[model samples]
Target chain A: MEPAVKKGPADILYDEVWELARTIVDARKQIGALRPSKLKTKNVSAALLEMDEIVKATEEASNTIMDSAEIMSSADASDAGYSALVQENCSKIFEACVFQDLTGQRISKVMTTLELVDTHLQDLQDLLGPEFDEPDDGVDEREGDEALLNGPALTDEAISQDDIDALFD
Target chain B: MTANKKDMSILIVDDYKTMLRIIRNLLNEVGFKNIDEAIDGVTALDSLRSKKYDLIISDWNMEPMTGLELLKTVRADATLTKLPFIMVTAESKTENVVAAKQAGVNNYIVKPFNAATLRSKLTSVIGEF
Candidate 1:
């Protein structure tokens, strides 16, 4: 505006550097919106947990149904026709019980996806520094019912029936 | 000689109603009709005190008192010390088995078991059905 002064290469470079810096700050602010604290209360984890509970509930129900069906199939051997019908229906129930197995596998896949999400969120939190870390709520992760009911260990720490029998021996 | 298979008094303990029903049904099918049930170790203990049972088949996981705890309590009691107690559980951890053995459990059976397996364990503990 004064006398049409021509900007030098250094001044032009400084303006360009500041513009790039402003853009980076804007990007950082956008990323900061994705707080790691949300992972605790987010539906993603809660939904996955619900899916796990569904698998367990379905397994229990399926077991009950299958057990009942087995009992019925074995009942009234004298009534050949009725017994045959029961045997056939029981077969169907047993076949239908596979749904629980399939559903369990499917939920397992979803749980894997949830794990991936958790891993990525963890990575993001790491990148964001300890300032984004959540405070400890002082909750102990209990297994089940006061007792250490860790229901069928998946690790190599689990033993076999033979091993258990050996203990009595 | 062993007592009649059907005459043997047995008690099955578990917190799950479905599991109790399944075990009861299986025991009935196997001709052990003289069977009682309790929902947890505490209930089983009360039942044990009030009635006489030749065998105790219990789940290891339960509220207030676990089967392991019950086994320890039974071993501590003078009359129940000699009682045949079998701990039935899905937990097949070696440490858990060691604990049960240390607690003086007569036998252990893993879950997802069949009537035949249950019968075999029962027979092993209470002298052949």
Candidate 2:
């Protein structure tokens, strides 16, 4: 009888792929809870669009997982076969997870921003009666009722000016 | 400006703080003393736009921006396009490599990988070892 092949890069790649599949499944469930609150805004249309892109990316990543499993189970499991390619391929998929995580965070922050914007708009509607003439400078800092919304303002935070200038030049 | 131990930074973009910590520790173990973290792609893009990184190690399954989008964006940028990028993902499909290669990935690594695999990926991708 042939000796059992030792666990090599293919096995490593397979286990990694399986673990990632599990992570994706878990993330999908977690994201379902977040989708509703994120979609609840007009200003968040951009963020919502971003969310769509992320979801698609996640799906695409999930799809690739099947290939990982296939390659492992096939003749490719041997080091003499497609193990090198599998290792390389696995890294790329792993890379996608990095971006997915980023997208999720961006969505969360944007959702928070959207909520704040909604609260501010409501206060402005109540204060100026919703028909105030547009201020020439359009910079109104009206303090409203007891509904104190606390968080970082999006405008106040951004990449620095030096960085911008460097990128442009 | 001179590059110090603190200046040779690596940016890790992933939504999971736990994963971020894992990667950071691995990079530290691999002699990369300086590191930055981004929770998602948009923020990562912002960071990439703002500073020059020695390396970018990212996850593939984030929301609002996946690693591929970030890679595409990074590749689209003329100045920052050449920066070395390594994708650390759980997805191991063949199409993933095709897309990532098309998007200009430097190297890819699968998750649950050890310190050796991480180091090897970085070395193979950037040849900075």
Candidate 3:
């Protein structure tokens, strides 16, 4: 067989760069121009705010239920106007149950955020490819968490603020 | 001017608008009307500097600057150190509570609380409403 041509360091570096560019092009095709800042501010923050609302709704509803139960328990039904008391408390319960509707809507918003994040993550996976797994080799999990603190990324491969928080956390 | 607790202006800080609204309503139930709002610690700090407040009720997990950081900053400042602060948290974690207490938080309120709990926490800090 003919002697094979040896590649220099410069040639090897060019090949690696070309490979990265190809991977990015492919990922861009998959993600269709991901606006990372939007993901952090609008998507993530909105989802979190929505989830907060859900928590508030849940807590308010439970509190209402408990308050009514306690009121009903403390007051005797045998006493005059007991039926009126029960009617008022039951009406409050009906009002509190409306929280379910708000919670459902908030959950839907969170789901949408998760789905979008998954798609963005798919972009990252594609760009990183199989080589992403190699970095974990011989790395302690706790050390890996520290290693993840790759500060503000370059504009070409920017991570959202939430992504940085995830890395730090 | 006499500093009446009921009429004293209060500053409420929470990143979430709904939480601010809930706290505002509860504070109303507690019979305090002059209230202001801040979205995060930075804004709250600014408000503290520009205007005087009787008490501060701040949520723990705010962005940019957390409530713990805010507390530390407040305590560090001789002017703001004496400001009565009641922290609000969704978590009942001992470590967090210890940290807040160490940072000089006057009191803390766990989430899902009602008017009574709010009033109770408020009472401990600023005296009975």
Candidate 4:
């Protein structure tokens, strides 16, 4: 019977590191597959593109309706009742523009998800040995300026324009 | 001489075309007719040099040069210093606000914002519309 050999701390640490590396690789693959630009089974890019089209179409339709209404209202012999109705309809079209705001929020969320995945992949690469020469993307050295470059605030965490105004006061 | 709010020549700098369009539309709603756009700070600086804009509204995060960089550049330039500059960003951090203020930003707006918020910011920086 062979004697049992106990693994040293270095050996145990190596195993743990390799395990982490594998898990990171798996996570990277999953994120890449799910990314919007991937165009895979669950592509978020497609949904965003579809929403973009919808927003464009809706805006165009709304603008056309508003233009026609304005022309009709300006006519010399425009009926008072019809003019009022046109104004009301135009107001509704303006309100319907709220879709752009909602869609903008959704697109921002998708962008955040993609950014998180990218950061994780970068962190993983840093943990492991560099596989390739580091490119001069200018981002790594530019970290100093990016400290205040935080992108849009989440709805719940966002401050109001009034609050900002009070800051100056 | 201060430009009238409605007639003010405005330059809007943002990396996102969607955001530029949204801001343009909001500006239109608020009666600003003359609006120009640049996709980044470098381009924005060029636009500022070529033409005189009554006001500048810029986003904070852009490649090559950021809105803060742009603001600092405008403030440093003898010709462009004192330009009414507004910084629009999603970052609501106190440090960022202080940095922008120290960099000579006339006002700061945090996203996502509506036409009313934009109007208020514009009014505060420029004057009553």
Candidate 5:
């Protein structure tokens, strides 16, 4: 027979909490790992400014985590009371904030990376011709890129160009 | 950060004036100039229709129109298809993330975020910085 699975109350709670915690941690680690290479591409002054913001945010998030841990440890998980409910809710709030904060950090990092990518893409595009920048001025090409990026229109309810023009007036 | 002359313009939309101002200031610290603000999604939609914004950062929960609704509208507009949109919210439930991802949000930010977190999310969503 297969062995029976077992998870204690504290074990379950910890697991749940840790699952979210791990997401936050892993995301932050990714951002941290990406930063050094990113800094290489940016100017010193800009890097310094970004580094300062990152450091301050890191410190603040650390404090929040510590506070959450303290709260979780002190709260009576077994107690079927209102205070316990409040504690649980508060704990969830903290975890959610952690994820949000981590995501925010990650987004900034991604943008910087994109900036680098855009620079590289622009360089490549420039090498081709002025047309590279205006690749889709035609209605069909413009429609194609739009549809490809944003998906198809919700409805097929068509209106004439004069109908649209009249509304513009 | 290598100064290649920051070209991005951020339009922050929130129901709360305080929140709008705060987000704008935070973007400023990130070396972003040409920041604009709107009090709610209605005003935001108007601004979005008339101007070309490189980025649209909006609060998720608002009166009349929420961030998700605005995001949907933005996605529907062919002129703004490639524009990156982010939803800033106090809701962080797992389902919320799933929903936002489904609604075509390029990224998300939770309320009470500090400078680093904000910067990081922008980097991850927009590029690797």
Candidate 6:
């Protein structure tokens, strides 16, 4: 307040640099917010694991029914009624395997999200332009495999098994 | 050129371990015994080079290489060109099917398939079970 100090180019440059630093800090916060939540991924992973166990259990149950049917059929031919019941139960177990399809679809969606996040992070990294080291050449590690990177289709968009079968005809 | 399903050496390629297990189980249900597995297309190509496989069942969405890429490579190779390759994928796009068909995939199976569908597809490709 004693005297008015005229800002020089150096001072202006310093302020500009400080503003850029602040902008970077803000960008970091924004990125942190934009990043895919680890909690969501963890939750999905846990659910998928549970689904897998359930699917395995169903498969095991179906196998047991088949084995039991085989043993009963070999041991005695008069147990047709019991065999029919077992077959019906096996069919139900097989139907339960549909969970695999649904879960697979869901998991694929999550994977797509993760992949998108990865791409964003990569893009951000490129924008930052190597704060510590030389800039990366922007080559994909799996560049040769890029052509094959088609992830799973969304459930609604996926072709039905019947449709695929029709191709054979 | 049908091979015995039980005796045929098959390679199952997929990025998902669960999928690999599911396919192995399904193949087992259909009487395929000599089955081996690869986690992705790279390993699949290596396996194919090392030893002969009667059939290949591969998932499309894989890293470092996809089932479609593997199919293209297989078709490009003189020795492996005629190998009976089946693509199993969750993708149902007509374009995807067209691409696979253009690449010379022996058969295609959409995901959420059961043993019956798999069996039928196998029959279609390898002929009569």
Best by TM-score: 1
Proportion of true contacts reproduced by candidate 1: 0.74
Each prediction's interface RMSD? 2.6, 18.1, 14.5, 3.5, 16.8, 4.3
What DockQ, on C-alphas, does every prediction get?
Answer: 0.50, 0.03, 0.09, 0.34, 0.02, 0.33
lDDT of 3 at B69: 81
Model 2 over residues A65-150: C-alpha lDDT tens digits? Answer: 54454445453455674767777667866875676687778778777867766775555455445366454685446543111122
| A111-162 per-residue lDDT for model 6 (tens digits) | 6656766776776676566884566797657644353354677777767767
Steric clash pairs (candidate 1) = none
The CA lDDT at A101 in model 5 is: 67
TM-score of 6: 0.55
Q: Give the alpha carbon lDDT tens digit for every residue of A1-169 in model 5.
A: 9997898999999999999899878766755554645555564446456666765665555556545554554567677784765666577556746655664775586667567656655655654458647666556554421222222122343333233223323
Cα miss at A129, model 4 (Å)?
A: 19
Worst 10 residues of 4 chain A by lDDT: A34-43
lDDT per residue for candidate 2 within B3-91, as digits (tens), equals 55335668999897767867876676677767899999999999988987878898887778888888889999898888888887764
Alpha-carbon shift of residue A36 in model 4 (angstroms): 19
Sorted by lDDT, highest first, which candidate order results?
A: 4, 1, 3, 6, 2, 5
What tens digits encode model 1's per-residue C-alpha lDDT throughout A1-169? Answer: 5798789999999999999999889767756665545655674676677677776767666675766677675667687687676767777677767777667766776677688678767767766679868868977676433435668888577777777777777
TM-score-based ranking: 1, 4, 6, 3, 2, 5
Q: What is each predicted model's overall lDDT from 0 to 1? A: 0.79, 0.68, 0.77, 0.79, 0.66, 0.77
Off by over 4 Å in 2: A1-169, B1-7
For candidate 5, write residues B1-129 as lDDT tens digits.
223424677789988665676676667667677889987788899998888777889887776877777888888889886788887766554445456677788776666677776787678666753
Q: State the weakest 10-residue window (summed lDDT) of model 5 chain B.
A: B1-10
Summed backbone clashes in each candidate are: 0, 31, 0, 1, 36, 0
Over the stretch B1-129, how does candidate 1's per-residue lDDT look in tens digits? 226757878889999877887888878778877889999989999999999888888999887888888988999999889988888898888767777887888888988788888888878977656
